[model samples]
Target chain A: MSVDVKTVKRVAHLARIAVSEDDAERMTGELNAILGFVEQLNEVDVSGVEPMTSVTPMEMKKRIDVVTDGNKAADIVANAPATDENFFLVPKVVE
Target chain B: MSDLTRLTISQARAKLHGKEITATEITEAYLSAIDRANPALNAYVAVTGDKARDMAKISDARLVKGEGGALEGIPLGIKDLFGTEGVHTQACSHVLDGFKPRYESTVTSNLWADGAVMLGKLNMDEFAMGSSNETSYYGPVINPWRRSRLDTVVMPTTHQGDGGFVSAGGTKTQRSLDNAQLVPGGSSGGSATAVSAFLCAGATATDTGGSIRQPAAFTGTVGIKPTYGRCSRWGIVAFASSLDQAGPIARDVRDAAILLKSMASVDPKDTTSVDRPVPDYEAAIGKPIKGMKVGIPKEYRVEGMPEEIEALWQKGIAWLKDAGAEIVDISLPHTKYALPAYYIVAPAEASSNLARYDGVRYGLRVPGKDIVEMYEKTRAAGFGREVKRRIMIGTYVLSAGYYDAYYLQAQKVRNLIKRDFENVFAAGVDVILTPATPSAAFGIADEDMAADPVKMYLNDIFTVTVNMAGLPGIAVPAGLDPKGLPLGLQLIGRPFEEETLFQTAAVIEQAAGTFQPEKWW
Candidate 1:
């Protein structure tokens, strides 16, 4: 199934990455190429086949859910473009 | 003194213990080599001179005290993907404008705990997405080894689908490849280039889908992607969570063994990190493969494969046979579907994993009217074209209407691919061998790759199957192509059986002998 320019734009929007008209048009062809490529999967007889969930089947190791470590709010926000008091600054969400 | 940069990890380890050379001396040698070669090769994106020497000094002290760790005194390069505690850890992407992680990745921490010295961060495909190094925000890394102008091979192209086969002596024969820049395959491109160029004793690299093995093969270096969860993914930048794995690209098989021994560990931090003890991989080297069942997967012999690659595969089979391996013809019938299935699964997970980069905490932030617009703008401006493309593909597949037809179907195909390998191994196949790449390193902006992205994805044709199964695979340099570029043979081992890969690869390394480029860089 090939993606139209509309589909490409929608996908890019859902992905939250901006794509200009030119890029979306280009991605239409590109994404279609990829979609066409992966279409080969239709040939496989997976009628009763289970989708793979994990590479290794192992019991999930759990630890005590208590706070093992913390108190480095500074380190967490150290690389943010804008921050105040270890709080990351972003465009105001609400008026 | 002789050029200390030429010493392999094993050789460097022995000399450090023998007191013939200090860690400081070896680090200096590699630093100087990197300084000279990096400008031309563009292998290392950052050179941590002070840190390397400081770490080397610590190693020297430990060696003197007879308390050195496994990788003591060995100077290594960290892939840009791995966080290196306050060092450059951007995954070679522009999105991470100035990211120096506060925390160290669990893999790099393990490396440091073993006394390995870090030379610097190497370049890679941004977010380890693309097959060629061309996708890096930092310009594509130039391979240290270039094709000789006088030497020529039948121009071979093995893309995918019906048109993959380019006729012999195809249109790619240009005037001179002697000076043309070839890519050390990505996303571990820089890791392979640095190790091959002798910029570091070895380099830490990762593989989601053949990142470690493809680059290593192109540059005539040795690289092994241990079983998924063999190395902790605690802090290595996540690409495709389920598929991403950490390993090493080193000068030779023994060095790869030495590095992996230190790199693998069980971590409480990464639930996926296997709890099994790391083997003395070095001890596995030189072990007899007399009774080992080396399976030659007949499905790997893809049509339109170059004569040299086919010949190299034959040579590998013969070498193992000579070393007393019982060669068995095997069938992994689902091999052709592996790469296409990977394109879906890897991207679907990548889109999810990359969602965390939306201008909130770290990395580039492009201001907009609102937070949502801000995220859209920042991600658009931040991520590279290939990254965006994969994100779009992933977003499309996981979208409401297409989820079942695309993503789920791909995952089911993944199960079939895994079953293919399982069936082979269950039948007493020790390790399956195949050609590492379709052709030797191609030009930087290869015509075929530029024309179609799927052509680029096909570069991992043989290697991707191993990752699909979560098994260990090693790429060892075998023979040189007609163009004088190195060709590599891949050995896919059973899960967590990296020792067997090391043992078998060492035999091929001995038979084919290791290759090094004529250093013009």
Candidate 2:
């Protein structure tokens, strides 16, 4: 319900963003405000109401389950920062 | 010929068909205008002159063979968010600075198939996260109309005027004066600017939360957000998947119609793309709105709304009434909850969609001592402040313990908002009319965005409901605010009912005497 600075910092970390202590404090405040605003939704009565997902009641269109990629590996990898042995190379994960 | 550059796509198509001008000439003219105006406006991230010329040559050959499509030889701008095969699609973020997709998006491919020439990729908010175009790594696009005539000759400020001046009056003033730079609106700000300044005839744009319409509104250009499934999302870099829809930003309704037709197509690769028939959007144009019920939602009249916007809404309603449209007062009681719901749902989806870009897949990656470090270093170095902030908030809402309270609850509310629209339309409200934004364009120096995200989010207030409802909405250039910047009136229609929306919009355009840039350009 209430997002504290610690929780905000944890969120920033999980999101892979670098936020300073001051920014964490600020984000906490903003998040609290947003939460406060969202809290208003709790006031509306919907005892028998169904939560709507889409305006139109149409179902998601079905597509073929087959997989036949164009196999443009070289083309797809052309934009990567670094590649080795036809694979994207990243820093070593294990020590 | 200079005047021809300001012509709508339909007008251009007619001229191209008649051989009054060659595709090469039109493409060259737009390229030359981009050359002249881009430096002042900063609208494009890259200008593909060679590709454009080559495409024009092909279009010319098609014309010679009598194989011209609707968009044949028409020059257009593609937003950087749409991946171009060889052209860089950076999402306006440094994180993917050199990231170019090996494939083209279905929408872009469709445009190319229709023989539309690419003027190059236009600027946008970094990863389409911000409402203002300011977050782009390429710097904000200055509205070309702002610069004075002398400024244009000397420093390219020839069209620069105060932020809110109407385009027609501003253009007249610009003609008499020296060079100055005017404000093109944001996200699709660059595209809108390019079209407004006659740098291009039209530009492709994406609307997540009014990115197309808001900028279109600010720049006095026509922008449409078609039904969500109408355009394929396969090649487009994801930004709030459920909400993002690629559309066109053009000078007029007919051009928007043409661009929409050119862009809409079914793609098997994008499962979300509809397999339904793509209609002749242009044929829907000029259809009579007589006896059509137009709803004016009283709930959209938020407190503290500027009187100017209200006056424009009243004037628009009156105009539609005189044109045989039945004006009905309606209520979307859940309208106020839309902004909050959108902020929650869009970011939540964005978080999931963007998770793939975690430094290893295919974007900018910073080498680090470890894999975890690689992600942190890469993301910290790559993403802009706004993007980072969004991802953080998004992750927070979707986290384990918070999921039910935030993410699930928001999803439930999203349904309520959607049903509100369904109820009204079922009640005989053909289309809903509201102000596109609470106010007009703000200054570049405005730091209020940092202080108040809610106020900033309110810019999408009128537009996001359409997205939430998955309905079609168009921002018509209604009138100007006191500051003289263009304010738009939004017409929202039922799902897949773009024809009705465009017809109603055309009536409003005719009645309002919508701003035409050619008269000024």
Q: What TM-score would each prediction reach against the true structure?
A: 0.95, 0.92
lDDT of 1 by residue, B330-366 (tens): 9989999999999999999999999989988888999
Native contacts matched by each model = 0.88, 0.55
Interface RMSD of each: 0.8, 2.1
Q: Please write out the lDDT profile of model 2 over residues B89-205, one tens digit for every residue.
A: 999988887787778889899999888899899988888877778889999887644312322222233565553333443342323422333445567888888877788899989
**B52, model 1: CA deviation in Å?**
1.0
Q: Model 2, range A3-94, lDDT digits (tens) per residue?
A: 88889888877887667788888888887877777777666665555555554455776766777686777876777778876798877656
Docking class of 2: medium
DockQ of structure 2: 0.57
- What stretches of model 2 exceed 4 Å from their correct place? A46-56, B145-183, B516-521
Error of 1 at B83 (Å): 0.7
**Model 1 misplacement above 4 A:** B149-177
